[model samples]
Target: MVEALKIPTTLAELEALGEEVTLRIPASFEEYLEWVDKCEFTIEYFNNEIVIMGNASYYHEKLVAEIIFCLKTIFNKVTGFSVLGSNIKIHIADLISPTDFNADVSVVQGNPKFVTLPSGKKSNSKITNPVLVAEVTSKSTIAHDFGDKLLAYKKIESLQYAIFVSQYQPFVTVYERKGIHHWELRDYTRLEDSFVLMGQQLTLAEIYKDIQFEK
Candidate 1:
């Protein structure tokens, strides 16, 4: 949490910071996190902080499963890429704790490689690059998903598309990359609206198949 301390210019300060830097984490922190049941609390590393995600509602989980099934049908038959679920974290930075994202589902071009962490240890808990990321909005996370997280997801150089599916309605937003840093936004709400995401096509109705909303 400590930020903006003047960079140590002296040898003594360098030695002091080296020892103090490792003190930031308890020795058992990683060990505990590894054994923690994600079903209880979805934990993610955001910048330098650990973010505990709120639980998904039944509807949210159902939508996630449906969308994952649709994506698998397309990518598995044509793309030959790995289509993974939420537990797969994608590293977005190389900071102290690092910024990693856990999307509802991700269609990746290939499996991620082991990356050496700031602590000189290799972490096997992330997908370094993904092609498309999707999020099923929840009441507690819609704000971050539509705001900061959307911006962060675009910053991933390998990312070509970002899809946001509504949990409370039959709407979906797809951001397609046009060129370097250029993106096109398309929202599909009507059943007739066809989503042309990364050259693949699907109707909004197809995504919301067999799902009922409160009247």
Candidate 2:
């Protein structure tokens, strides 16, 4: 009988291991991630590797739901806009072996009717050109959220805004594109504080609805 290998204990070691595994055969790993029999997990494909994500907490999900509700309500009054579920994969870079990242909630532009892109092409695999993207933070992902993912997201030509929400406390960070590859940042810590992205407003209080924090 063979025992499973223990995972690395520290972040640096784990990252090194992940790189080693990805360099071995990226296609095989990517295929397994998209397999139908795969378990329920929020997986991320970045830098030629798959990141297995754990289930979000109850509050985390609720916060996401509320934000979606707000987004839908706002888009309903507008034209050529819609929101996407977390399952939508986004090809942030080149289509060939592109790095796909799933936004918790994404705001896209489309006609009031269901959209059929150029030449009536449609896809469930991945999307690009989202104007706004939002992410709800978990304890393990704070650094990746602000560092690595932020860099990747800003590279999207059509991406004008990137927002990060905190589940552990009443906090939010809004990144607005300023110039070519330049982003201006703002942080909100008060419940009454709100962040505006793509002409939509989201208050911190509404995000933390029926939830409390240790801080």
Candidate 3:
């Protein structure tokens, strides 16, 4: 028996090697482990391809950190609700899609058991469904987040609110579930405007409070 060949180290190498070797498609956990082990590119194996993700700009990190801090403070006191940032792993096995997404901020209700797997350990698995999911858009992924990804995210039965926070503009586009299979889209830019979410109203000013920018 021949020894298993080592995987290519670079994306270019992998592309070329694809023609020669028959790869053993691994499970989600195995895929994640392989991805982490092979770090030539900042990529994630979602759907089928290796999606190379761009690094976060400083401004993006600041915004995400602030938002996470605010959410954590709010949810910690609310009870039955917990807040998480991109660090969390959200697994969707319906079609073998295990996406480790950076959910600028995600809130869920219930205490989830932490489980360890080959890929990584998840402290909260209760996030099979998120009550609200927000993505702070960037220049490169604005279209994906607002367009295609928005549609894809809508397929999630537990998703009630999908909010896209614009990086170019100081605005937010909210898609809220209206009925059984319908969603109502709304845009909010005004500071004092309140957006109702799961019976809780959040004012734009409150969410963006203390937020500063270059211009």
Q: Which candidate has the highest lDDT of all?
A: 1
- Which residue pairs in model 2 clash with each other? none
| Models ranked on TM-score | 1, 2, 3
- Which is superior by TM-score, 1 or 3? 1
Instruction: Evaluate all candidate structures by whole-model CA lDDT and list the values in order.
Output: 0.69, 0.68, 0.62
Model 3 score (lDDT): 0.62
- Candidate 3 lDDT over residue span 54-82, tens digit each: 55556666767766665666565567877
lDDT score at residue 40, model 3, on the 0-100 scale: 64
Report clashes for each candidate as comma-separated counts.
0, 0, 0
For candidate 1, write residues 38-140 as lDDT tens digits: 3243455554544445446578888899999888876756665778899777777643545667899988787666556556888776766888999988666
Model 1's alpha-carbon lDDT is 0.69
> For model 1, where is the 10-residue window of minimal lDDT?
19-28
- Considering lDDT, where higher is better, how would the candidates rank from best to worst? 1, 2, 3
Best candidate (score: TM-score)? 1
Better of 2 and 3 by lDDT: 2
Q: Tens-digit lDDT track for model 2 on 1-215?
A: 00123322344544544421321123432353443124344456666655545455677777889878878877787778879878877666544445667788988886212223334656555677788888988776667678768878988888888989888888888899988868999999998998776676778777777776533
State every prediction's TM-score relative to the real structure. 0.77, 0.75, 0.71
The lDDT of model 2 is: 0.68
